[model samples]
Target: GAGVSQSPRYKVAKRGQDVALRCDPISGHVSLFWYQQALGQGPEFLTYFQNEAQLDKSGLPSDRFFAERPEGSVSTLKIQRTQQEDSAVYLCASSLSFSPGMDEQFFGPGTRLTVL
Candidate 1:
């Protein structure tokens, strides 16, 4: 079975541009999550989805961030009005269960976003 995967491993954007990142989770996984990591910092949770339902998005830094899992497997994270402060690695993870703290999350190689 395939593990989580992300696209466009690297991106360079000018400030104020918008970017979209994609994620493909392992088959049959029930939960998906997005995270943001600044340089030299640990990844911070950004949002969570159970199947196709978005359950939490409290960690998104601002309204510029958005995420969705419309079909319960593939997910997307969109960042609008990119800022230099938003330059970082965006990670995607998936688990077999919805219990975030208990279930082991499999992480994909992150997509590094650079805002010039």
Candidate 2:
């Protein structure tokens, strides 16, 4: 079975440019998560999906950021008008638990975005 996969392992974006990062979760996974990791900092939750529903998005930093899991398997995180502060590793994870408190998520390698 394929594990979680994220595209453009690295990306360099100009300030104010929009960027889209992609993720592919494990087969049959029902839960997905998106996180942002700044240099030397632990990942912070951004959003989460259960199947095709976005169950939680309280962690999204701003209105400029958006994410979607169309069919419960693949997802995308779109950042509009990228900023220097947005430079970080965008990580995607997938799990099987309906309750986030009980799920053990498997993470992707992550897409590193650098804003210049």
* Per-model lDDT: 0.95, 0.95
lDDT of 2 at 11: 100
Give the Å error, residue 102, model 2.
2.1
Clashing pairs in 1: none
Q: In candidate 1, which residue ranges exceed 4 Å CA deviation?
A: none
Give RMSD to native, each candidate.
Answer: 1.1, 1.1
Predicted candidate 2 versus true structure: per-residue lDDT over 1-116, tens digit per residue:
77899998999999999999999998888999999999999999999999999989999999999999887789999999999999999999999767737778999999999999
Off by over 4 Å in 2: none
Mind giving the per-residue lDDT tens digits that candidate 1 earns over 24-78? Answer: 9999999999999999999999999999999999999999999989999999999
Number of colliding residue pairs in each model: 0, 0
Give the TM-scores of the predictions, in the order they appear: 0.96, 0.95
How far off is residue 58 in model 2, in Å? 0.6
